[model samples]
Target: MTSEADLAWIASVVGDPARLRILLSLMDGRARTAKELAFLARIAAPTASGHLAKLLDSRLVAVEPQGRHRYFRIASPLVAQMVETMSAVAGDASPGDRRLRRIDPALAAARTCYDHLAGRLGVAIADALQARGHVAFGDGSGEVTASGRAFFAALGLDLAEAGHGRRVFCKPCLDWTERRHHIAGGLGAAFCGHCLSAGWIRRHRDSRAVEVSPEGRVALAELLGVDGQALTSGWPERAAA
Candidate 1:
């Protein structure tokens, strides 16, 4: 039930460059404080607050209060999907010649998709899951075969245990960098957890960039039946996270 007037107002709200940056910064689905978002968007706190207020009114963003801190995130998964899809398209369209630190050549290998794993590792795992016939669905409500469940269990990633009554399990998260799709949802988080615990990958010292090690290459091959090293060779090794 969206009124034309409301839509018009939202259009205005998202039209500003600063607000657009803020919205894009939150696409990874992580709740962020105004100051954090402001730093990411390179805007002032008051300005970020103003944009957040407008986004909140549009229902494009939601806020949570934690003691003295208030945090904001995209209003819903639908919003996250929309932002990711749009960012993917926009990033492709505007392949700037300038070399930015964030746009490293290795972005595809390991990076953050909001808060979870994304990039080449993300894309390949997503593709392999679908290719292996383990997942059969689009962005939500996927069905995983029993063998698929067992296969992951061998990797120390039991979906039942990893899922642990959280968000939807075995769902697809459309890739913003690859323009394809990646496994997301509870299952996705579980898989990510397994990778982390296995010493296969490590988050960059301070950045969202993820680096795969020699061990990760061996582990991903043994666990996922796909050679992580092979897939990332000459590919965008540094895909966004």
Candidate 2:
């Protein structure tokens, strides 16, 4: 069970907008320098340093030092989940919250939830997998079926290798923007990695939004029967590029 002190500390660490921005920036599973986070949060270096120090002390974030550089990232997958869930719960936009409202469309289209995909594209992939009998869902979790194994193998994904980690093999994450279920866990991460390596999706710098490339459109359409053009139809030219 969690103690009151733990809850209070979590609240305090996550309560500040600047720190929240820093954490959100690290949600893509990449370590970032203080300078990068400072730029993303639009705060002064000194102020960002102070905020980072607090996050480090609270164990909400961790750092690695290599020569003259220090990179920081969320402490663990658990930490990432906490931040993502909080972002989902607090996602309702106020009438005057123009900044968030503007980012909403892009975020819903294609974005990372920690190491896995969680957005329209993510939800679509999940649906395709289930529809084709590639995966089975039950009791809030899921597992790849035999046909699913064969399907991923054709794409060069070895489920055995992807399941080598200590994390759960497969699970469902509620998409905050889509309000639908997308796959999470080891399988989800592997699929995301495969898409990235295959040039099926390109991630935006300093942002969670991803763009599905033309090649990706063809591949997804052929493999999963997903309408790639329709998926990206609403995206601006800039986003597609």
Candidate 3:
């Protein structure tokens, strides 16, 4: 049985409204400075920090030091996976197929936290990979295809070199928004890094939402075989070039 102290630890952190907002903010899969998180959560800077501190203490979030800037992010993708999975079960759910319909709405577009996929970006990436034959879902897991090997090589990622054992290579994460599976695991982390390094995407102010550059669109298409122009018609023209 779970101990009361364990329950208390979780309760102390999660029962908070602002802290919860902070977690939601990080769902975009990008690292954010504390000031940006404060704005995103609509809390004062000090309050945001304190709440973030509590989350950090609980291992629900992590920090990155970039020169003078200190950025906060979800501690790990496991946190996102746990939160999303719990959300899927709805806590009050019964043992049945009724669980299939629950979906997080905002995730249908793009969102993430720290170093992993979240929201719509997560959902779409997973879909595109599967659709284009780079991946396939089976046997309670996913596998990278031969096509995926060439695909990653083009982006300059060699997952084989990223190391083996004690790390998941490819895994499906449930998208909170679209109620579908998206790619997670080591491969997902690598993809996010590639996007950032290539300047194909950027984070918005005070939100986990990602803005895909027009160039990013073209880059994604070139890299992942996605149709950049067709995928996002509303992206400004300059970025698309």
Candidate 4:
């Protein structure tokens, strides 16, 4: 059971601007070195180190030693979900808000929410799946239907293997940018991996943004009836409804 004290403690750890920045920097599901995290967080190395130490102690982040350097990443999908939910609450900017304009177009279109996809494209895909009766969302969780399993199987994704981990197999993750739910959890991760391996999506070199390849447009249309072009170009107007 969680106590009020525990909640307050976590809030303090995550409330610091610098630590929040560091946490957001690792939301791409990539392990980053302290130096890299410092640069990304726009803080001095020492400051970043202190923040990282706090996060480590809080178990919000984990570190792995790779050769001579240590790389840090968000500890788990649950932590990532918490951060994203908080971000959504904090970033309730109106559509006309200047802060919204400052957002990277590509990032707003398609990006990774931890290991799974998020943003307009992600939401669109989820919508498509739900529309096609491939997946169903209910009370923040999701269920992959019989046809859904067959659909993924046809794409060479084995749902049994994807669900082997302790993580939930399918769930709805609220999208901070899209103000909608995109699929998350183990199934979501497996699908994201399949997209990458199939060359349907390419991650940006410096950011969490993902670009849908030309082949991706055709493939998604054929496979899931998703409009990759419109999603990647800008926000879908219907999504605002």
Please report the candidate that would top TM-score against the real structure. 4
Using lDDT as the measure, what is the rank order of every candidate, best first? 4, 2, 1, 3
Full candidate order by TM-score, most accurate first: 4, 2, 1, 3
Q: Each prediction's Cα RMSD?
A: 11.1, 13.4, 15.6, 12.5
For candidate 3, give the lDDT of residue 59: 77
C-alpha TM-score for every candidate:
0.53, 0.55, 0.49, 0.58
Indicate the TM-score of model 4.
Answer: 0.58
The TM-score between candidate 2 and the true structure equals 0.55
Candidate 3 lDDT over 40-69, as tens digits, reads: 999999999899889988878877556777
* Residue-by-residue lDDT tens digits, candidate 1, 144-197: 787787777776776777567756777666555554457777778777777778
Shift in Å, residue 57, candidate 1 = 40
Once fitted onto the true fold, the runs of candidate 1 whose alpha carbons sit more than 4 angstroms away are 1-102, 234-241
Q: Which candidate has the top score in lDDT? A: 4
Predicted candidate 2 versus true structure: per-residue lDDT over 149-173, tens digit per residue: 9999888898898889688988877
Cα shift from native, residue 227, model 3 (Å) = 3.4
Backbone N/Cα/C clashes per model: 13, 0, 14, 0
lDDT on C-alpha atoms for all candidate structures? 0.69, 0.79, 0.68, 0.82
lDDT of 1 at 198: 78
